[model samples]
Target: MKRQIVTLPLSLMRVTSIDWDIDWRGAPEAGLTDGNTQVVMNQVPRWVGHLDMTMRDDWLRSWRAHRWQAQGRVGIYRLYMFDPLGFNLQAIVGRAVAETGIPFATGERFSSGSGFSPNVYLEAAAAASAGDTYVTVTCTDADLVPAPGQIMSAGDWPMGVVSVEANGDDTYTLGIQMPLRADMAAGDLVSCMATGLFEVDDDLAGAAPYGKLNRSAFSVSFREVLNR
Candidate 1:
């Protein structure tokens, strides 16, 4: 069976600083061995990584108002060992920071393996060693859409649309909702023509720039298919 996953792409606004904390603790003993050997294991300092991001207000506002329904915010953020790496994880961390209404100053700490780290070093290392992993976040308004002529599929079924939007963000969100059936599955692929408007950075406007807004064809995978 096939399903769809809808997601929002989050731009890396900027990294204020990268930081970490190390903690040393003893491990629990398994049991007494046959011999009188009490195997004392070495206690190593565990390292936790953190990345503080100062996001632009425009980006945060656009994401909250249009994409996530105002789910997350900005603040000092930390990531553990097991969190999904890259844009997916960062988008979520951004949301959490936004939702808690926490100051952009205080940081939150989590265990290393709970799968919620946002540290760039760790993420890069993980990505380098293994093939890139895919992470999904709530759909955002500023997300880029798949362009026309882009091929999307639901399982093995190919899809087609009239147009598409290309915001250049990781995930594709529709500026206007499309006509879809109610029985869509969670992992189903959606291929359609997409078009939308986007706010470009001032710096990039001069080079290879089209307009304050441009229309284009795009393609995206659904993170979660919504039930009608």
Candidate 2:
């Protein structure tokens, strides 16, 4: 098999958080008739995060806007190293478009240890709760095993096993294995999410915030690949 590496710029990596619509109407409003209240059928924004990953240039170009299907396959791999506090890292495997640069089916296969901090986990969970589906995998520098945050138990906000099929003239099948949880099954739909925040610190003056804090800000990244 031919292999190529694609390095994604830190600006492209992102995490998106969607808000759950508790009520059919947008929000609680007084003096508004039931019919007049606008019902939002979709979720809204809650929080967002940005991340960075390096991959093959060819892979990045091929998956920029194309679509592909994916599925979960069983395999043994080592946990990659990540520095969530140091630098952002993650991994995923699935079928992607050859031309459109869109990923049809995708999910997290592994995550690095440093990538699985409490803040990172919470951010990922929030992304799932909103409506976005997709898991971020962080691979070791050697790419041998599951990285740091490999979910060993169920409670990892696991979505269902996702199967993606391309649309239009595209014909491809992709499967993604995700952390199994109580709220998810084998046929639920989900999207990949990334979130980022900026912080300012006096200790690291003139030092880049790639792994350190510099300012206080949050950003969200979102992409809908497949659902059910």
Candidate 3:
């Protein structure tokens, strides 16, 4: 399977570390007269792993929004972990939640140059099947139709627009570079970043920036979902 790095937009707080721990529920067998250990295993033992990471409080509003939507409940998400040293990609499918409360932290402000906002959000209108070149996208107030040379990203796959057609009822069919890989359910958020745009830092002059630099960490405990 093609795997890409997972990015939680709200989890951009100070991510200090990613700690992964695994457990194997195996029972050790006792030895007889030799005083040595002997084990008899019929099947593989239960295996599990958890991912823990810390984030500062720089972007607490975004984190709060995420937490509110989650309702402090567990939900399954496709999380990607890349190991550069081993050249391995671990795409985990399991349930996750925010198990800790946000702590108040006083710190320096986070600063960055102004960035362009996305021209339009590519919202999937229906479940898209693989090998379908044309896709239906939600029409926004701008209703901007992508040009042939323009690029759009769905998840991690970036594709150029070959053609576009309005399907009516505030929806359009986009002929992309190729068909999609996995199916995209309706309302999946896809971004079309505004390329070649510049913005001045006019709003940063008098902002107090009450929140601390985002150091709020997110810890998710998950167990691999095994297929029957």
**All predictions: root-mean-square deviation over Cα?**
21.5, 17.8, 17.5
- Comparison by lDDT, 1 against 2, better one: 1
Clash count, one per candidate = 40, 68, 13
User: Per-residue lDDT tens digits of candidate 3, residues 1-228?
Assistant: 322222233223223444322234346777779887877653322222243445434345544544344333232222232221211111111112111222224432223211211123568887787667777888664424455545555664444467878777878778864446446789985545211111112222111223355444444443322222
* TM-score per candidate: 0.19, 0.20, 0.36
- Measured with C-alpha atoms, the lDDT of residue 228 in candidate 3 is 20
**Among all candidates shown, the one with the greatest lDDT:** 3
Poorest lDDT segment (10 consecutive residues) of candidate 1: 121-130
Across residues 1-228, which tens digit of lDDT does each residue of candidate 2 receive? 211212232222322332211122245453556556544442422111122333234333322411111101111111111223322333332212111223224533212201121112211111222233343222222322222232221231223324533323322222333322224333333222222211112222211122233222233222211111
Which candidate number has the best TM-score? 3
- What does candidate 1's lDDT look like per residue over 1-228, in tens digits? 222222222232233454322323346655666755354543332333343444434433433333232122211111121222212333534655422323323354322111221222101001111111121112333322333333232222222333443335434332211222223333333322111111112221212112234421221111111221
In model 1, the runs with Cα more than 4 Å from the true position are: 1-6, 17-51, 70-228
Give candidate 1's whole-model lDDT.
0.27
Report the poorest 10 consecutive residues by lDDT, candidate 3.
86-95
